[model samples]
Target: MSVDPEIFAKVKEALIDALGVDDDEVTEEATMVGDLGAESIDFLDIVFKLEKSFDITIPREELFPDDILTNADYIADGKLTADGLAQLKERMQFVDLTKFEADPQVQNFGNLLTVRDLCSYVATKKA
Candidate 1:
């Protein structure tokens, strides 16, 4: 899916400002955690910036979905069960989970959200 350039610019700006990353580093495919060096704390600032910039209320569950990750029934041996993956997929429609599906380790979930996914989310909110 092609992200709206305006949305992408705002998202890129938010990310750059929140994560203190160089402009060149915030590519569409860059993972928030892995590529942009965004820690969990940075998400708060990023979300706040996005909400302010776009005038949209962002529910925490829509982005984080921490409940699913912590649920005992959905996890086994540090990996997400089939049902858990399904739930995650349903919740995170903006995210591309194809690669994550191959290795559904719970730890890897944090690195799954990319810049493009974030832009898509903002576009949905604006719509």
Candidate 2:
């Protein structure tokens, strides 16, 4: 689905205001943690800011559910099982899972979440 540029701008501005990231750093493909330097703890603040800025509620689990790495249904022997990977890919469709699909590492799935993913999620909520 095509996202509205206005929505993208609002989402980007919210992320910048919340995360203190430079305009150059908040690209569509920028990984939240890897490229934007977002820590795990920063997600809560980010979500809050986005919600407040957009006047919409973002479901926590929909964005970044916890315990996937520890859940047996999602991980096996330090890696994501085939079923687990499928589930993750379905849940995080906004993310580019090419690398993770090639390697199938549960540990790295979280790393696939990018700034564009956040924008897409928010845009969907608004829709």
lDDT of 2 at 47: 89
Off by over 4 Å in 2: 1-3
lDDT of 1 by residue, 1-127 (tens): 9989999999989998998899999999999999988888999899999999999999988999899999999999999999999999999888889999999999999998999999998888888
Which residue pairs of candidate 2 clash?
none
User: What is the C-alpha lDDT profile of model 2 across 30-53, one tens digit per residue?
Assistant: 888888778877888888988898
Estimate TM-scores for all models: 0.97, 0.86
Each prediction's RMSD to truth: 0.7, 1.8
What is the Å distance of residue 127 in model 1 from its true position? 1.5
Candidate 2, run of 10 with poorest lDDT: 61-70
- lDDT (0 to 1) per candidate: 0.93, 0.78
Q: Which segments of candidate 1 are over 4 A away from where they belong?
A: none
